[model samples]
Target chain A: MSTAEPPAVAPGATVAELGEEALIALITPMLPHAPGELVGSGDDCAVLALPDGCAALSTDVLVEGRHFRAHWSTGHDVGRRAAAQNLADAAAMGALPTALVVGLVMPPTTTVDWVRDFAAGLAAGCRECGAGVVGGDLSAGESLMVAVTVVGDLQGRAPVLRSGARPGDAVVHVGTLGRSAAGWALLEAGLAPRAETIARAAACLDAFRAPRPPLHAGPALAAAGASSMMDVSDSLLRDAGRIARASSVVLDLGEPEAVLGADVELLEEVAAVLPGTRPRELARWWVLTGGEDHGLLATVPQASLGSLPDGARVIGRVREASAQGPGVLVGGRSAGADLGWDHFG
Target chain B: MSTAEPPAVAPGATVAELGEEALIALITPMLPHAPGELVGSGDDCAVLALPDGCAALSTDVLVEGRHFRAHWSTGHDVGRRAAAQNLADAAAMGALPTALVVGLVMPPTTTVDWVRDFAAGLAAGCRECGAGVVGGDLSAGESLMVAVTVVGDLQGRAPVLRSGARPGDAVVHVGTLGRSAAGWALLEAGLAPRAETIARAAACLDAFRAPRPPLHAGPALAAAGASSMMDVSDSLLRDAGRIARASSVVLDLGEPEAVLGADVELLEEVAAVLPGTRPRELARWWVLTGGEDHGLLATVPQASLGSLPDGARVIGRVREASAQGPGVLVGGRSAGADLGWDHFG
Candidate 1:
């Protein structure tokens, strides 16, 4: 990812030219430092710490066409997205990410610079989140896909599993919702992508590629005594539904306009993409069903709900679980049937 | 994989009918029980205990058309190969197999039964080495590629790193040297199409498709005070070269015949196809440079070598590194360079 591109790489130094050993040499220094990292990028296995009583783990995969468009997201963006998604899952469990292991597959024709940029994206994501890229494998592939597994340190807190949600908790979201979806729509429409802050839009597009999950948010929520939490990879509603179903509780959303923020450039972009359409429809769709944004979602009991830490906002409430569908309710209405992203639909 | 030949699922129902949720439901129960399994297969990550210490982790990718020819290995065989390779790496580290998480990508045209069989292979490999397929991500792809990360418990044993070999250590092999290489030659040569054990030659074909690493060989070496060990996924001469280079030592094979057993059969089959007298040359090539078959190579001090554990045998010994070159020696003569598999070349 050096924008100071001096013809990509030195002449005659192909990705194949580097091979596996040299490739490891090129990528190892980019990783963050971890305590129990007996083995990092080189060799076969990576050894990581567990401390006295805690271990948090999560993994996510991003296929080229299914989760991203190469034309829309740069290689760095793709790496970030891959790392972010996995990191989000670890955060959902109230874990502080310690190390990241990546498995990358790309066509042999792909440039060496692209792989470097991709690794840099993953490194930047981990660096920003305070985690290390511990180990990874690269193979000649037909299409691009990134698989990342994140191992985290809980610092002795009990993992907050999805099934740990209880009734009458406040449903909250950490980080902005619907921005990635809106950015995706803008890019899909061939519109020039811009945000209220050009940097924010770029960051949001970057978030779409490499999400900076509020890993700090999970520990904060746990410290704040939050009950149940999960990363919102799927839409807010769909992910909330997961907590609801797993916890056997009903999740009720307050209102759409109530959750809308003042900074709304992405919504405007979506509107520009579809002329004569209101931003509400696009935002509603993104909030309710779009998957892969990888923000964090949490639910807390009524008493502890007031203790939500920074970067989190109350978006809904949990109700009693019935025999019917379990999910967020809008205006006393359920988010209704599932429309979340499906792997094979 | 039903041994009784269960009905094959149509390609459309691959991941389509079962979906992600159903596929999880189908395989989660098949995983073996483990005390360290804090999390397994259900949630975003599979959690396991670190044995009051650290965990050894390794990942490898087996891509279709690159790692194994799909026509040779059944879908089940591919799955087994994917899981076993990683497990072997962990074992080579003297770590007890604890868990495995896989990221599998394939085209939508794959069959549900094929996936089910693949899962069976993964579960089987896990069972063979005291591990389980704890968690995995399923996605649609352009080709079938299985990426697996295997986690193991050290049980407090010092991890055997590739850099641990010393000048005075004895090199040893814990499994067969060149069966899989010969298997490939047999399949590539259509000479055995009419043999009585044509299916047997096909079994050799199966060997290349899915190498069953001697799972027990690793920990035993660790327990017997082996100094350094690694899995031979590339070739014997090549993988041994890795340990030598990493430890900055020289390896001398002392004239052990490189061919034995069914490897001779492979030469016979090749002779039938090419009709010349080149068994010695052909056998030499397969034993020296074939890839895939994951065998273990270790270096142990000779005093402790007599206490060699089951399945382990001294094949060579370490010598002082020379500035001229550092590599394997055969028959009191320097061996040819470029003796192992290099993916890029």
Candidate 2:
């Protein structure tokens, strides 16, 4: 953030000193190559082969201060989160991620090393989901913002839409829940400064910084007959409401305590570290209303429940919508409204 | 930019007052539905059919202040420019654009009507290229930033790459040149305030605000056997240099004046309005180094010249790179280093 003499020389220089092209040169080699890319970066467009004849596309934006603080998260962390969120979106559509195009805006004071590390993390995150960074754009701005658009191949299968959940469908979930929110809370409570010294805070902190979404479960759940699916990016309660509204059904989180108890237990230790915090209550709130874990929330037919992918947890059920309208219910009660994060709100 | 009271209540409210979801609800209906889209907005990802089995991808970012001033450009203008640049990149790759995903960040004070207008312009731009606004992400930030990623179908033809320009090929161009730069200069020179009073400034200003790249010519040029092609988003000399370097050949503008005279004449009236400006010299410079025109620059085999698409101008020729290395030569003279805009520089 310093405007002082660039702080380095040559390849180690800041973005302003190195300029856009040179910075791109330093970052491009750090990215893993796409398997069958017809054309890579340094061109008008990157060409990729989509043998399936169909593509699933999603875009996500991460803004500094609003999404993450540079002090709390590294460039690598931002890159991973940016890529993971979009890749998870693709997975939610029952597709295998193939390529991503990034649009990055940063301050001139940003370091080239940070950009390289960001690219490296993007490559790492994409590699996990069988995707590659095909191309990107760069610009100078007051804050660092990463916008990633990921493309995925559907592999000849019909996409599982959010509106396909049936009345008798079983609502299932795969991957961690509420951990990212807990991590965020911990960070907000100054845990970030003491993270290295506190081993108990590591899990939550890591979750908040670079989420490890169960991306593989997306396509697997679809193949296992998932009728409807979405990534839990904006809290379980809110995203469930989205599915409910889209499918014109009620997503009943029957016996919420029993369904979310495991997640609550997972975050108890981390929650306990915060002063005046009720571990169980805090963990439960995080599980229900916390987002950014990128967990898969899906509905599958009751008949196919037995064939669900491993690690899947049947936590709820789809019910017929009443005169009250489509919504999410927890413990046979309304889950309230707007419990998830809203940027402007 | 105002922090005034809620503006005009619900639906006519500011982004902060309406929140993300409601703002999205207002914008979604304005976009045109993409033809053959299996899934559109309101999903984790949009599913699009790519019958050609190949996809051309490109991303471009436009930041407020850096890319445009709110006082000078309307939200619609920004949206059109953002979509145009990415779509042009796809066109440069000899593909037909099908869909786009946008990642938009705006200040909380932004008006809902502005957002709607932006969406309408995005739809308008995409419609021009046979594409649609499929899916996008929105976030809150200090400045308005639009990041668009476009996907295109290659139609079963080999990609025309910048590296395929061979010696003896004729360099061709299709679309306006330097007019965008002239438009930008006009705005920068306080022409925006008096634009309506000066009919001569409208063309340049419009060109700068929303470029109309001849997208249909891309596939046509490819089918006509263009060896290498790229969009001139960054001045003719600079972009030509990119192709030369990529193909390891020199792009020689054998008769610079003859090739660029028409463009200079087109901008003469606009330049004459600006005090202390050398009309012909400024126009010529704009032609040589002004970017954002989104003009197609291509290299075609001499044998295919007669078959080239309408409006295609033969401006230069490809020549073997000597020991001096690959570059662009104007009138048998070397084009100087870095004559185009560099964001960081």
Candidate 3:
């Protein structure tokens, strides 16, 4: 048999022109090598050494047009967003991220540059949490789609579950709130941020594209005695409600203005530029209902509040479940409505 | 706060009408429960207790029109095939399957019954390999897609890598080969099998729709001292070439006819009914180059040949790499050309 050289990759080659083998060769080196990896790519499966007996697993899927638009997001943005969401799920369970496996389906005409950038972002995102891209599969489809599955090691710690919250716990949040949804609104409204609001607007856009989840805070909170924990992905009220239902308790936001005033204040500058917006009310609504910033939400014993992780603020408190049932309440009253994102609703 | 009952699900409801929450409620119960699971569905992530220190990870993606046409295969068939392929990758690495996480993208119009059946098939496939569906994500898209990632425990055994093969090793294969491709050909040609070939044709079609990979044989071969191994998802020649290149050796098929004659004979009955088909020659070609049956292909020392797992048969021998470099040779001559599947090509 003759050993033939693979065709040189062109600058503007489509995936169909480059073929699967060459495309794989191009992307493989971009993946971060894990220190615990026993076997890497080129095998039927990647063998990884888990740090502990218990492992946490989560998956997330992003579809073109539905989750993103090509014109609005770069390939890097898509990849980073996809990785961030799934990794956040593991962090929500107080686990340290370890590895990720990707499933990508793209139109045959997709450019090689786009895929290369996507791989770079994926590797970068995983590297941030000490994880690596271990294995993946690729296919051709009518539209671009990315599905990522992340694995995490608990490091001998018990997984912090939402069902562990108690009536005397303090409700805490440890990352940005509402910035992503605000950025999306700005994009949809086609409004450019004024000179005074440029930094906040940019931060909003950045959060919308590739969020910096407080992954380190997860394990720290658990170590400090968090009663229950989860990442706020579907809006503060909805996610808190999830913990409430699971724990059979009520999460009561004691003082809306005091608890969320800073987040509301940050959005007022951008809201001022929108023609029909009521700045103060809109900013408050955004803080209460906007989602996708991937903030860590938790409940801790009142005695352990002093030992909570950095960037954490007391947003509310847990109360006994009444005849009204487990739910989220503001100032001892029911929160307005659940405005969380739903794929089909 | 008010405790409200969820709307009752009606017969033949679409995903859009049921919404994300209710749809998930319907599907989660159908997933198999793992014995080692520390946590299951409803949490941000599922926590699993692995049996060993190391785990094997693999992913596979199946696009609607690209991988399977809905008119030819049911949703149950798609789900089963998706789970089976990923699990087979783990088996090929000599790992026992532990858990699976699925990412599904579907159109809003998909029926609840289709999803319920699909979950059943996925659960059944994982159950066969002693695994459970631990977690998954769902989204809406224009076309249906299934992405599955499986985790397997190595049980403290060293993994069998493709780079471990050496000269004088016996090249062996176990399980069916080329049957899925033959079934695909039958579907493409619109040639129904004659009465005499009905049973064989039915087997071919079943293989195409839902491949039954021999899961238990992988660890068996490894325990018996296999040097290298992989599943035959691509054509035999293409996969053999991979092993050769990785191991830096040449796989020499000294007696192709005697090695694969039985598989060739099994295809001839169906071939006889196709117009313009050379039954014997075409069947031989299929046995040589067709793929997607998920059979195990391995190399072992000659002394261990007698200890090989059940259904395994020697098909070739490994030789030191020559100046021509690593490749596959049939009867001491170069195999004509590679015709394995390429996702984008």
Candidate 4:
């Protein structure tokens, strides 16, 4: 964990030099115009129209060192990653993301270009997810912190909640698993310094920098009658435990071979490049506990599994809670340890 | 400017010791349950029902050291202050605040009790402003920062924007001005350590620590047909300049005597307590440029001025923009220099 200072600003081109209003002016034009927004930025509040009369709201914070390293990611990557996580939360609720409000805290010495790139990346992420950046606040702080709150329109559909899973339901997942964890490991193992490793694990490194969650799959799963759903932000085992406890059911994740299936080969390839580690063991751990992928996990009736959305894999089944308590069981055994990111921990 | 470390944590009671879940469990019961909220905290996203189908959104960030000193403010005061600013923004839009989503960043060494008090203050603020703590995100950071996003319901009324003030409109304000600034100065002048000064300047200190914006006055003024409105978070002169430029009208602030009225004596009393400062001069500065009072400022036709909400005071008038350019003019002249708080500066 290097605590290196961020690169120095170019002479006289600091945030303080540009001033707050001017900085806002620089980023205002870059914001994508949100159609139907009654009010946008540069006002006391942004007025938005939610035709369905209901809104799904979620917020996430990304700290400079705790969430992303300046040396490992570009400003654009940070912005995109911040927006993606919040958007994924909206998706988890079976809603279409409509707008984002960002609160940015950075030092006065931060460069305008860095701020501009960060805004651009936020806009880009919003655009990618069919959303718009409607408003934001900027403040000077000791370090960079991006707090993003996303609003989504439910569009007349009932939100998919984590407590709705029933016994005998199939637990399915859409999007990559453990790739970000593998990428993070690669970067930590000096992969960024080696051209061969960087080239070989480019996708992994990119995943670690800016994740591309399967956002659309959320609404699709909802439409397909998902009984329960949540975004896999903390890790499969840990997140699945949330659903199990909330739904009062036991989630029995199938064997690793059945769960990983084709992805096993890719994980194995990623693991093979890392020195002093067993490829199969590392690949398995990464697949099950790797978080930050922002993938969608849902529980649906067995009958609906055949009609699941594209690329969704059926990896587990819901069972009646046992005396041992409601939680996730992998291959008929307890996971033994929680291998997820805990903020306080 | 005493960069003092926050008081040391009680032995073995750090956030890391309690863990994230335990801390969340400690605060969850303290959150106010917002009436009619489709969903509250403890979910991936909070689902809110906006019967009118429109929502006003706003966000603000408060950074440690930059925004407040831990030595000067309790965690609860910081939380209340953070929530008040965002809620005031919503009120400035002529909307009734309904919910808040907070993103809190703190160091890993922070105490669980500190976090608990912070959450309680947030809930208390929400309760005071007719809103609820819907959802939030927490992350570890180098410094403490509270990023609050408030959502409000318009209740079928059109938002009073800063751009709608017409010539001949009277600018009015509801709530105190300069009290927070005076309090900040008093604290800076070592008043906090002096029992006599603290006793005499309690109102000022409290205003600075936690502003109680006249939130109901926003919708009330809107109902009375306010043409333009905004919260006076920054200096009255600076914030007034925003409406002036947006409306393409000149804002002529009235004489200080008329604007300050009975508050003059109170301001003088506060100034009298500070050494080496002229009472009248400091009072004038505090009234014109002191920021963070979170007061509601609105513009309405002169004919409706008599029917303005309770505690509302007429402070200026809107006029056609002259060749000099649209902006705020105090006592027949430009403000001359920006004395407001500048985040970067």
TM-score of each: 0.92, 0.95, 0.95, 0.95
Output the lDDT of residue B112, model 2. 85
> Compared with the true structure, what per-residue lDDT tens digits does model 1 show for residues B1-345?
001113434555767665666665665566565547786655655567686558787777778877877776787888788888888988888888778888888777677778778888887888887787767788887888888888888778888888788888988877655667767766566543543255555545656767788878788888888888888888877777777777778888754444244545564454344456476666666666766678888898888777887777677789988876677676557766457665555
Q: Give the lDDT of residue B94 in candidate 3.
A: 85
Q: Write the per-residue lDDT of candidate 2 for residues A1-345, one digit (tens) a residue.
A: 001122234656788988877677767766776756888887888888877788888888999999999988988999898889989999999888888889899999998878877888898899897788889989999999999998888888999988899998999999888889988988888866765466656777888899988899999998989999999999999889888988889999965458866566668877888899888888878888999999999999988888888789999999999999999988889886469989898
Complex DockQ per candidate: 0.61, 0.84, 0.85, 0.84
Error of 4 at A278 (Å): 0.8
Could you tell me which residue pairs clash in candidate 3? Answer: none
For model 3, give the TM-score of chain B. Answer: 0.93
Q: Which candidate do you rate higher for TM-score, 1 or 4?
A: 4
lDDT of 4 at B237: 86
Report the lDDT tens digits of candidate 3 across residue range B1-345: 011344477898999998888778878877887658889878888988877868888888999988888777777888888888888888888888889999889999999888888998898888887889988888999999999998888888999888888999999898887778778778778763442258888787778888888888888888878889998887888888888988999999754457876676768876775679898777767776887788888999999988888898899999999998988898778874366888997
User: What global local distance difference test value does model 1 have?
Assistant: 0.72
How would you class the docking of model 1?
medium
Model 3: lDDT of residue A316: 91
Runs of candidate 2 with Cα error greater than 4 angstroms are A1-12, A195-200, B1-12
Residue B193 of model 3, lDDT score: 42
Which ten residues in a row are the worst by lDDT in model 4 chain B?
B1-10
Residue-pair clashes per candidate: 6, 0, 0, 0
lDDT of 4 at B145: 94
